[model samples]
Target: MKNCDFAYYLSNFFTTYLPGHLNVSENTVYSYRDTFTRLLTYFKDERSVPPDKLKFSHFSRDSVEDFLKWLENTSHCGISTRNQRLAAIKSFFRYVQVEQPEYLMLCQSIISIRSKKSPKPTIQYLTGEEMKLLLEQPDTADRNGRRDLALLSLLYDSAARVQEICDLTVRNLRLTSPPVVRLNGKGRKIREVPLSAPCADILRKYMQERKLDRQDRMDEPLFFNSQGRNLTRSGVSFILAKYISKANAVSPHSLPSTITPHCIRYSKAMHLLESGVNLIYIRDFLGHESIETTQIYAKANPEKKRAAISKTCDDSSAPKMPDWNDNPDLMSFLKGL
Candidate 1:
């Protein structure tokens, strides 16, 4: 049997295009791959079309629309997740449109499928006092506690994604004057975030105790498990939850109901915003692709909004109006009405 054009283009799109040409991160490629996997499974299970026999002709706009509905209604995916799956499919069709002009109309229809709108999520973050309580949970007397302290501090201070923290190495840390840690952000974008003196101090002690300060160990994972491997995203979350639970037990009313590594990131950005840091700087600090992404911190801060309003308000500038009682003509008019 002749090889299908869909298989031919799809293979090159993943192997050659996404990694080599687009230079997307491995995680992004994996996410895109998962979208297609689910899509193929949908055809196999729902439409009775086997994977090996499937072709481009089977993927009409209506079929793709039905698959998206299947994702939301049947698979129980949220609006955000369904939209993400649609985005991946649209991206694939976009690449196909450029490669083969013959399927231009079909590709356009699939690519033009609008994503479902979802409500914006409320940003969760910790206040300064609550953050202090959480950070103090780690007992620095033990070796593991010291490592946890350093990990939590750096995670909060850098406003880094969990994956970025996992990808960190001794070489990424610059402990000298003007201390900074180089973060490998999405799309392989490298951003050097300055370290706070307190965080740097903790890291210095942790590195010395672990003997990671030696010249021979630059490439070693900064934070690792007992098996001597870099921590996974789940590992980072688990570490955070452990500390949060301890903090909550001690002062249950003070801390937020739920917390994650990403919440630590949100807390960092919120603190910076409250300190009157510029949105542009926060965007760069948080490794956001756009300042718009960082604006959520500003929008979520009610205190900042009050402060801005208070600054612009002036009681002395108020204009006085003639009293209604003093105006007999207005009073008479009112009575007539």
Candidate 2:
């Protein structure tokens, strides 16, 4: 079968538009690619239309909506995942509209399809004491244990995403005065996060032991597996889980039952907020595109909120309101109201 217009634009969207023009990250490209893959699967299995014969005429707003429903109902995807797939489809149509204006209305329809509302995920993090206890779980005497400690320390200290930690190279580290590690965040935005002295010292020692201090090894992965390959997300998670299990055993009910690499990042942010660090600084430190994203940390912190209220309540200058129960006239008035 001949290549249809849909296939033509779709190919260019992935190959040219996303990577070449927009310069999205590989993970983003893969996510967008998966959306189309699932879409084609939907067409082939449910609509009796094979990939080779599918055309733009067969791709409609209703068909896309049906595919989203299939994702939730048949595939058992959560609301967030379903919304992400919809976003990918919508992105494709946006590119389509730009390339071929004739499809503008159709593209707009797909774009206008709102994302399904999902409940806000509670931000899970560790307190300073809990984080310290978890960090102490790794055995520093063993080579692998030392490596795990360095990895976990940097992971928490920098408040970096798991992928950012995985992507770290020897060149990203600056083990000098005011030591910092440059993190490449989502969309390939680079931000340098200052590391704690202790964390930097650990990483410096770890790098030296691995012979990564050599000039030629600058491009090598900062943290690697036994196979000498960069640590995968699953690998990082496994390492964290091992320590978490040990920490839980040592101090029962101290840590969360389950902890992901992301929880470390949240822990750092919460620690900073509790220490009176500005939200804007936290936003930049976390490499968030908006303060709104960083605000979730503040909003999720009940301790900080309670402290602020307590401080306000303790203010000496504020006049206290007269108790209505102390006055019979005021009580009668309230009763009449």
**Candidate 1: misplaced stretches above 4 Å?**
1-3, 252-254, 314-337
List model 2 lDDT by residue over 1-337, tens digit each. Answer: 2458888888899999999998999999999989899999999999999998888888778999999999999999999999999989988899999888988888998899999899999999988888989889989889999999999999999999999999999999999999999999999999999998999999989999999999999999999987889999999999999988898888866677688999999999999999999999999999999999999999999988898788888567877666676677976757655
lDDT of 1 by residue, 1-337 (tens): 2448888889999999899889999999999999999999999999998888788888899999999999989999999999999999998899999999888999999998999889999999998988899999999998999999999999999999999999999999998878899999998999999999989999999999999999999999999999999999999999888888888788856576578899999999999999989999999999999888999899999999999889987889866645666657986656654
Q: What CA root-mean-square deviation does each model show from the true structure?
A: 4.2, 3.6
Q: What TM-score would each prediction reach against the true structure? A: 0.92, 0.92
For the record, the alpha-carbon RMSD of candidate 1 to the native fold, in angstroms, is: 4.2
What C-alpha lDDT, on a 0 to 100 scale, does residue 295 get in candidate 2?
94
- Model 2 residue 143 distance off true place after TM-score fit, in angstroms: 0.6
- Compared with the true structure, the alpha-carbon lDDT of candidate 2 equals 0.92
* Whole-model Cα lDDT of every candidate shown, in order: 0.92, 0.92
Off by over 4 Å in 2: 1-3, 313-337
What lDDT is reached at residue 59 by model 1?
85
